[model samples]
Target: EAGVVQSPRYKIIEKKQPVAFWCNPISGHNTLYWYLQNLGQGPELLIRYENEEAVDDSQLPKDRFSAERLKGVDSTLKIQPAELGDSAVYLCASSLDAVASGYNEQFFGPGTRLTVL
Candidate 1:
């Protein structure tokens, strides 16, 4: 099977500039997720979507970050007026319905690396 796809694989920005990242999940998957990973840290969950509904997003920084999965498929995450602390790797993952009868393993895409100056 093909893996998830992300564009620009790397990004660099100065603080206060807006930034956006795109994600495309694996086919036949209905659940999508966005996560953040600081250097030397495990990926932290940002948001999870069951199709078009964001089922979990408590960890997302609302002041400058927002995301959407309008078609319950490809997703986009945006940071307006970015901050230096926002420099981290943004990852996208996909899995079968989490509650489905089976082991639901999250398959990750190559992350978009953002560096804020």
Candidate 2:
């Protein structure tokens, strides 16, 4: 079966440009994750969702970055006025209900790499 799918695998934009990334998670997976991976660093959790509710988003940059999983299916992350420091890989991941599944095995998409010039 195919895993999570992300669009626009690569994007290049000048600084201060707005960018958005799309993700479609696996069927029946109710947990969604958004992560940011900087060069030479591990992925950092940007936000997390259970069904359509954002369960964890403390790490998300409220000023310029926002995300939504409207119907608990597809998700979108947007970064307005993107900065040079925002150049990184945005990853989408999904997993079955962590509480019910008893494990946190997440399937990750290829990710969208954004470059700010």
Candidate 3:
């Protein structure tokens, strides 16, 4: 079933520029995730957080990428000084309390595609 989705499905920017993406998860869902998908590859988790607390962000590129969940609701992901390698589809997902719900289904957004020039 189709549900969550991102805005400005496509974006193009010059190298070294910055970009941001927004996500609004399903109501009542307490867990949110951000992922990056390269061409011909599966999406990889960049960050996952519960409420406003980040629980997993080891895969995120701290040097250039950052994410935040505001008031445990809407979330945003950003990239600064984007490079050629940063071009990819950024996906957002949400689920029930991940730690307590044990394997809850994740609802994913269509994703925002970024192209660096």
Which candidate leads in lDDT? Answer: 2
lDDT of 1 by residue, 1-117 (tens): 889998769999999999999999999889999999999999999999999999999999889999999998899999999999999999999998987998799999999999999
**Candidate that beats the other on TM-score, 1 or 2, i.e. the better one:** 2
TM-score of each: 0.96, 0.97, 0.95
Q: In model 3, which runs have C-alpha deviations exceeding 4 angstroms?
A: none
lDDT of 3 by residue, 1-29 (tens): 44665776999999999999998888888
Count of clashes, each model: 0, 0, 0
Candidate 1, TM-score vs. the true structure? 0.96
Candidate 1 local lDDT, residue 108: 97
Best by TM-score: 2
Off by over 4 Å in 2: none
Clashes in candidate 2: how many? 0
lDDT-better candidate, 1 vs 2: 2
> How well does model 3 score by local distance difference test?
0.92
Q: Assess each prediction's global lDDT (C-alpha) against the native.
A: 0.94, 0.96, 0.92
Task: List all candidate RMSDs to the true structure.
Answer: 0.8, 0.8, 1.5
List ranges where model 1 is wrong by over 4 Å: none
